[model samples]
Target: MRLPKTAHTSRPWLIHEIAGDFQVEDVWALATPGGPGDLPRLVSQFVSGDFPRGAPLIVRVLWATRWRLGALFGWDRPGAGLGSRVTSLRQRLPESVPPGPGPANLPFTPLYLLADEWAAELANGTVHTVMHVGWVPDGAGGHRGQMAVLVRPNGWFGAAYMAAIKPFRYAFVYPALLKRIERQWHAGTGGAPPLHT
Candidate 1:
C-alpha cells in the first residue's frame, strides 16, 4: 500500500488505489477466524462504539465502502449497526472494562471484504488467515472494477503482534504479505496491467 508522505506523521493507514469502473457497485470484506465467541470479543475490543472516540481521524482510499469498510479507517460509528452486537456484549462485560489502544499509525488505506460463515470456518480450520478484498474502479474508465486482496493471519492478535514486532514485521512479514496481495490482484485482474500501489 502506498500513501502520501504526510501519512507517516499522522495515524497509521493503508490505502491501495485499484482499477475498475467507479460507477459499478463494489464490495469490501474483513474476515477473521475463531468461533462465535471471538466475534463478540473482537467486535467489543477492536470493532466497537469506542473506536472513533479513541482513534478519531482517518484517510481512506476514496471508495463507497461507507459503513462496512470504514472501521479499518477508524471511521466506524457505534450507530452503524454494530450497536446491536455491542449492546449484547456490554451485557456480558462489566461497566469498567479497559479500552484497547485504538488504531495504529501505519499508513495503508485499508480495503476489506467479509466472508460467509462456511468460508470463514474453512479458512480458519487450515490456514488461519484473514483477508481483505475490494471491488473498485479500474482507473482506466472501464466498466469492470478490480478486486484487491490482502491476506493476513486470522485474529486481532495479528495487529497486536505486528505492532509489538514492527521492526521485524516491516522488514520481513509485511513484504511477504504485500507480495501475496499483489499476486492476488494480478490473478484477479487476469493479465491486465497491474495497478501500482
Candidate 2:
C-alpha cells in the first residue's frame, strides 16, 4: 500500500544521513509480513526479483522503452553511470564497507545490510536512486517490510525524465511490485538463506 511520506521520514534510518539531499519519491508498505528477524528474508526476495518478468505488461513495455531510449541517447553507457556521471553514495557512508553487487539482472549496489534495515543504490545518467527497506512492526505484534525510494535528479533532463515516468510508476510498476512481494512472502520461501545474519 502507498504510504505517507512521513512513514519513511519518521524513521531514523541511516539513509537520512547519506541521502539527505535526495527527494523522497515514494514510500510503500510492502505486503510481506513476518517476524522481527525476517528482514533478510524480505530483502533477499526483493532483490532477487526478475523485474519486468512477473510485472504487468505495461511495466514490461515501459522497461523496454526506457532501455531503448537509454541506449539510443547514451544514457546507460558505462561511463554515464556511477563513479563517472555521479560519485558513488558509498563515499557518504559513516563507515565504509566493501561494496556488494546486487542481483545479476539488476544494476544496484548494496550500500549496507543491517539487522533490521537494508539499503541499495543505482545510478544512471538521468538519476541517482536509493532503495531502502525496513522491518517495522505491523501493529499486531507481527512485522512487515516497508520501502522508500529516494532519488537525486542530475539536471533539467533528469528532472524531466522523472516527471514523465511518475504516472507509470504509480499506476503499474508499484502495484505489481507489491503484489509480487506478497506472493513471495506467503509462498514460504525467500529464494535463499538470510544474508546479513
> In lDDT terms, which candidate is top?
2
- CA lDDT, every prediction? 0.26, 0.78
Per-candidate count of clashing residue pairs (backbone under 3 Å): 21, 0
lDDT for position 137 in model 2: 93
| Per-residue error (Å), model 1, residue 189 | 11
Residues 1-197, candidate 1: write the lDDT tens digits. Answer: 43332322221212222211111111222222233222222222222122122121231211123334446643333342223212222233334443222213221221222221110100111111222222222344422222222333224643453344445434443344344434433443211111111
**Model 1: runs farther than 4 Å from truth?**
4-131, 142-162, 184-197
34, model 2: CA deviation in Å? 0.9
Error of 2 at 139 (Å): 1.3
Q: What is candidate 1's CA lDDT for residue 70?
A: 45
lDDT accuracy of residue 130 in candidate 2: 86
